[model samples]
Target: MHGFIGEFFGTMILILLGCGSCASNSLKKTYGQNSGWLFICLSWGMAVTMGVYVAGMLGSLGHLNPAVTIPFAIFGLFPWSQVVPYVLGQFLGGFLGAVLVIIQFYPHFKESKSEEEGNSVGIFATRPAIANPVFNFISEVVATFAFVYILLNLGNFTTGLKPFIVGMLIMVVGTCLGTTTGFALNPARDWAPRFAYTIIPVPNKSVAEWGYAWVPMLGPIVGGLIACGLYTIA
Candidate 1:
């Protein structure tokens, strides 16, 4: 129960702080050029670090994202039988985190483009300026590959420093690719917030693009599985 709750809470904080900062910065136009990516990567990395420190001791540290959890299960780092609980915890926690962000940003909800405020909200939920499913999935696959590879290698480091490296890697990817697809390396990070965006009111907001949403969700899962398989064979 502790592990499950810890995962739930930790993931919530991860998305809320990391993605929340990205959304707020954009809404306010406060960041300089490329600052959004930098902010997101930094925030996400820091969130991971903090979440790990808090829950690693309790055994739920690695389940912070489905990308991490699913691959771990594939590689036996996490038990295959337990995969369902961990994923469910992560998803639930993420939804809760999105709910909290909505409450925190309630005043700005009306300012959003949607005429009817939806339930979910966050900056990390990516919406392409233009729809390009193939390119988007490719971007997510590449980004998730980078993320999981770094986790496979750097995960051995001391807990205190591991998160920083993770953050830096994310930062680099976002700097290089965030403009096109928002560089959502984690499925939870993208969908949890998008779920919120759908329910939250934004004035004149565009409809949810379900067609493009699956790319990030499936891409990262596929990328993580591939990396884990490679790791096992190596």
Candidate 2:
């Protein structure tokens, strides 16, 4: 119960702070930029690290991402039967968190517009810098593979460094691949906030870029399978 709650709350906080930095006006003043990819990546990485640290002690895996949960189900770290419940929790957490961001940015809602060339990109979802699906998919695969590989290998390292290493790995993946697709890498991160962007009454926002949403979702699932396979052989 505690573990599940941790996952639920941790995911909410992760999306709230992580997405807030990109969407919320106040947060942007503090951390946003024309190329704010680094801040987004590091903030999310640190968010996950802290969320997991707090939740892990209570037996929560702190997945925070559907991609992570899906792979765990496939690999038997988590049960297939539990996938829906876990994902439901994650989605709801993410949606609620985005609601918070909406409230935080309520005053700026009317100021935003819906267009590729304007501030719409900041309030809405992200797209690939190069706009090539193949490269974007590969970037996600590599990022997810590295993230899962680190999580798997953390058992071999000192307890104190596990979080740091995992967090740093996420940071690097974002720094390297973030230019493309803003480095979503996590389905829950994208979908949850996207749902809010679509449903909530925000000014001048387009549909959550559903056309490109699946890449982030499917890419990590594929990447996790690859990671699991590599881990199996290792």
Candidate 3:
């Protein structure tokens, strides 16, 4: 019960703050409007830090991303029995967080009349700077692999200064490796909110682009598994 509640609320805070940053940058007539990529990266890093802090305080290990939990489970770093609940919490919380963002930025969504003006799914999910499925998949794999691998070495990142260190790592990853595919190293972070955008009403919303969804989803899993394999081996 504690794990479920912690993961749920942790992931909720992750998306709420992270996607809120995206919306602020992309949506028109906002104070943070047109903020650059650095802004997005930094905000996401801080979001992770906050989420992990909350999750730890609430009793979970703070695996807010399934890419973290699932792979860790496969490697015996975590228990398989907990996988389903953690992922469920992540997805559902991410969805609700995104819904809250829509409510938070409704007027901004109305102001941005077209995808060109930044009213698009990119605010909630990732999109490649250059659209190439093969390379895009490669990007996600490489980025997520780097993220999860380094994360494994952190030794209980949910505690003390480690969460902040984890945030810096995320920032570095986003700045260095994320520019290619928006660095969706977290599958639940991408898909759940994407689903929300597809089903919910948002002013001048763009297509959800489910066709490209597979890259962020599968690539991160594969990469995380690879990281887990390598960590156990080395």
Write candidate 1's Cα lDDT for 1-234 as tens digits.
666776777778777777567556654322322365566666766776666555555566555778878887878877777677778777777777776766665555445444233212335477654578888888778778777876787755327677666667667777776657877777777777677667765434455566677987988888788878877788
Q: Sort by lDDT, best first.
A: 3, 2, 1
Q: Pick the candidate with the highest TM-score.
A: 3
Runs with alpha carbons beyond 4 Å of true place in candidate 2:
24-35, 57-59, 114-118, 121-124, 156-161
Tens digits of per-residue lDDT for model 2, 1-234: 654666677777777777676764322233344545566678767866765665455456667677777887787767887677667777777788888877877655555444542345344355777778888898888878877777777663224657667667778878876667677767877878887888887666655778887788888888888887788777
lDDT of 2: 0.69
Worst 10 residues of 3 by lDDT: 1-10
Each prediction's TM-score versus the true structure = 0.83, 0.85, 0.98
Per-residue C-alpha lDDT of model 3 across residues 122-150, encoded as one tens digit per residue: 99999999999999999999999999999
Q: Rank the candidates by TM-score, best first.
A: 3, 2, 1
Residue pairs in clash, model 3: none
- Model 1's alpha-carbon lDDT is 0.68
TM accuracy, model 3: 0.98
Number of clashes recorded per candidate: 20, 1, 0
Best by lDDT: 3
